[model samples]
Target: MGVHLDLSLDADGHHTFQWRRSDEPGALQVAPDTLQRWTAEHEQFRAATARWQQVMAEVDEHLLGDRR
Candidate 1:
């Protein structure tokens, strides 16, 4: 079983935020109200994530490739 390390809700009353560790106990739960908020917050994070992902992808392909 995986660990339930973190949990958060969005403003739309959805349990959109979540994280699991290598070994955690118990089920994760969130209220509907939290879900709504999480979605809005997630949107902001998405932009940052995209930028980081792009740079990471390039680093993986070039700097950390087997050819290195």
Candidate 2:
């Protein structure tokens, strides 16, 4: 099974991200900065993959258009 992530705002107005196992009642608290870094990295990866996919699609179209 996969771990679940919970995100919430604390009473002090700080963001909290927690990772919990399915069988566990408690969770491990993730640092805000760590979460921010992880989010930024994920977005960067997503953008790069999207650009790559678009380029591949263009290449496929360029190559297959004459055949179609």
Candidate 3:
């Protein structure tokens, strides 16, 4: 009744995405565009997280310095 999306990284570092459905015997491979979009989104998320972490670290340092 439902489909699930699965992601995997191969030994050579290639990413594979599969869509599995309860009614289907085999999983469907995702399209190249889907993979590319996912990759882009992941990179964007990582960059945003890194920037946020850097900002938080700077804020913490500033607060600690203010306390001293």
Cα lDDT computed for each candidate against the true fold = 0.62, 0.69, 0.70
Clashing pairs in 3: none
RMSD to native for every prediction?
11.4, 12.2, 9.3
Query: Candidate 2 — number of clashing residue pairs?
Result: 0
Error in Å for residue 65 of model 1: 5.8
> For residues 1-68, what per-residue lDDT tens digits would candidate 1 score against the true structure?
34353556666564654543443346455454565566567787878877988998998898667786
Superposed model 1: Cα runs more than 4 Å off: 1-39, 64-68
lDDT of 3 at 16: 55
C-alpha RMSD between model 3 and the true structure: 9.3
TM-score of candidate 2 to 2 decimals: 0.59
Query: Mind giving the per-residue lDDT tens digits that candidate 3 earns over 1-68?
Result: 34457789866586755554544545445565775676688788769967998999999999999999
- The estimated TM-scores of all candidates read 0.37, 0.59, 0.61
Evaluate model 3: give its TM-score: 0.61
Best-fitting candidate, scored by TM-score: 3
1 or 2, greater by TM-score: 2
Ranking by TM-score: 3, 2, 1
